[model samples]
Target chain A: MARIVTFFIMLVFWVLISGMFDAFHLGVGVICCLLVAIFSHDLLFYGHPDLLWVRDIFKVLAYFPWLFYQIVLSSLEITYIVLHPRMLEIIDPRLVRFRTRLRNTMARVTLAQSITLTPGTITVNMSGNEFTVYALTQKAAEGLPGEMETRIARALERE
Target chain B: MRELQEEAKLRMPWQDVILQTSVRVLIPFIQLFGLYVVVHGHYSPGGGFQGGVILGAAIILMALVFGLPASKHYISENVNKTLSITGPLVYCGIGALCILFGGYFLDYSALNRILPLGPIAWRSFGIFLVEVGVGIGVMSIMLRIYRVLSSAGTIDQGL
Candidate 1:
């Protein structure tokens, strides 16, 4: 079933990309997609029975806009810091480490990426539940793994 | 023996739960975009090589985040070897097909004899087919090289 889903997805993607409607083009696309599907279907679909795939998809859709807004907010903060006359005095660059409660790998990665994507904080390193982040300001580093971690955990929670 | 295992675990880089979670979510979209690039090469700035690299990068990202053994589970060495050859074969095969149809090598218009599509349409379709082949070949080769180099020619341990 997963294999079939992978195949159809690849086919639809191929057709969408290749606007040619001729029989020859469609036939070639089908052949190419079939070959790819047969070889790499497992790569695309791991098929964990416990996964709430549909619900998670919707959750992610809701999460991205929030992440984007956070990104904009951080960027503005960073921009202000950079443009300030007393930039050196205002900035207190430091590394902060903290552990997170999120267990899922996907959720963990999202948090790290979001941290890095946000301007004021960069995830310097991550190990297990512990993350070492570099923050441009003391304020940015104050609440380490606070809201971002909670939001990512909520976004990825199965329930 | 247990002491050595513990030491190894300590030496191994720590896994961040957030990174793992986000990469899991992002991989599918990255691969889908890669396929889009390959199929839409005719109309877009991207082509087989660029799309193939992007696809390869997705796998590399997986390996970096999840570890080598986990990624090998998805694309084994033998399958990788076969695909590396298959891509170029597909490309050459189309050219050979053109020859079989009594046209010069890589003459896509010759495909009209087999499909009865107009010469112009055949040419366009043929280019798409070749692009698919190139994309496949490049993607596989990139994965193979990364596997080899990162593992230091031994698939057992990867950096």
Candidate 2:
């Protein structure tokens, strides 16, 4: 089941990337997609998918808008911080550690990447559910595991 | 906090949830892109060798994150050997086959003796076949090199 999904996905991707509709190109695409799908179907959707993850696919798209918004907002914030005259006075660099509620491995990773993508914070290390982040200011540190975690959970599903 | 740091250091990369999960999500795409590179190599800038490296790098990425032993489970000793041998054989076999069909070595149009495809089509299709073989060879050999280099030629029990 997963293998078929992988094949279609690969085929679509191949077409998009190749930008060709001729029979030969299409035929080769089919062959290559089949080869890869058979080899790594499990890798794409591991542990007995059963069509549940198809819903997650749609749900996960909801995450990008939020993430992009955060990125833009944080980029502006970081720019302001960097351009401040009294940058050293406002910048209170510190390490922030927090345990995450997300149990799924992908969820935790998404949270970590979200945090890093948001300016003023950098994910330095992760151990299990605990993340050690370096924040450039007190404001950033305070936002640890904030609304981002919840948003990611909603988008990707928490295990 | 010191104890926490120490404990974090004790954990291996494969045991880290974030690394493992992110890799799972990213690896299949990486491989698919590599295949894309190989297939598109003729028309595009990249071909079998470059694409083969990408394919090999994907597996190497797996080994790096999952540790040598676990990576072996994914690729296996026997399969790796087969690929390494097969890649070159595919490459050379085509050359020899061309000779048997009355054309010089590697002259793909000569394949017309076996398949009734026109000489012109065979010429084009022949390169694709060679590229596929080369891609497979490169992917396998790249992984083999990494396995040997990282494990100090032991092919076991190291990164």
Candidate 3:
């Protein structure tokens, strides 16, 4: 079942990238996709992705817009900080550590990546559920693993 | 013996749960992109070599984040060896095949005699096949280099 889904996913991706409708091209794409599916079908869903994954995926899709908004907001804030005459004072860099309730590995990593993606903060180290983040200012530092953690939890948490 | 095992566990390769999970989630897409580059080489800026390196880097990224044992477990010695060997064979085999068809070495259009795709199509396709071969070869070799260097010619845990 997972293999079939993987095959279709690879096929769709192949068609999208190949951009060819010819029978021969389609045939080759099928062959290549089949090989990939056979080799890594188990990997596509990561350890028996159950029916709940559909819900999780849709949840993640919905989370993207909010994440994008955060990215834009952070970028604008970073720009303001850089352009300010008192940039050094504004850039009060500090490392902050916090524990997270998110238990799922995928969820935790998503939070970490999202945090890093947003400007002004970098997820420097993560041990177990604890994230060691570096932020350029106290304002940025205050938001460490805050709403992004909750949104990702909503998106990826299994239970 | 028990003490040695305990010591090994104490110094077990640093496993950041975030890095491991992130690498796992990222790997399939990277491999897919690598395949895309290999197949698209004819019309694009990249060909087999670049595609192969990208493919190889996915595994290298795996090794970097997940450690040697996990990497080795995912891609065993036997599988790696076979992939490395098959690449060159695919490359030279096509060249030899062109020769058998009474064409000069690496002359792709000569492959038209085997399956009558038009010469123009064969010429384009032959390059794709060679690129695939190169991609496979380069990827495997790149992985081998990393594995050997990291382990210092030993597959066991080492400094």
- Highest lDDT among the candidates is held by which one? 2
- lDDT (10s digit) by residue, model 3, range B34-127: 8878877877779899999999998888788877777788788889999999999999999999999999999988899999979999998888
Tens digits of per-residue lDDT for model 3 on A2-35?
7777778788888787786888677877877887
lDDT of 2 by residue, B14-60 (tens): 46666677787778778878988888787988999999999999889
Please state the error at residue A92 of candidate 3 in Å: 3.0
Judging by lDDT, tell me the better candidate of 2 and 3.
2
**Model 1, residue A46: what's the lDDT?**
49
Task: Arrange candidates by DockQ, descending.
Answer: 2, 3, 1
Error of 2 at A157 (Å): 2.7
lDDT at A87, model 2: 86
For residue B12, what is the lDDT in candidate 3? 57
| Model 3 chain A worst lDDT run, 10 consecutive residues | A42-51
Tell me how large the interface RMSD of candidate 1 is.
4.2
Note the residue pairs that clash in candidate 2: B41-B46
Q: What is the TM-score of each candidate against the true structure?
A: 0.73, 0.92, 0.84
Q: State the lDDT of candidate 1 residue by residue for A36-136, as single tens digits.
A: 66756655654642336667768889889988998898889888988999889999988788888888766777788888988888987666777778898
- Candidate 2 per-residue lDDT, tens place, A1-159, comes to 888888888887787787878888778778878888888788777566666676887877878898899889889988998899988888899988899988777778888888887888998788767789999988889978889888878877734
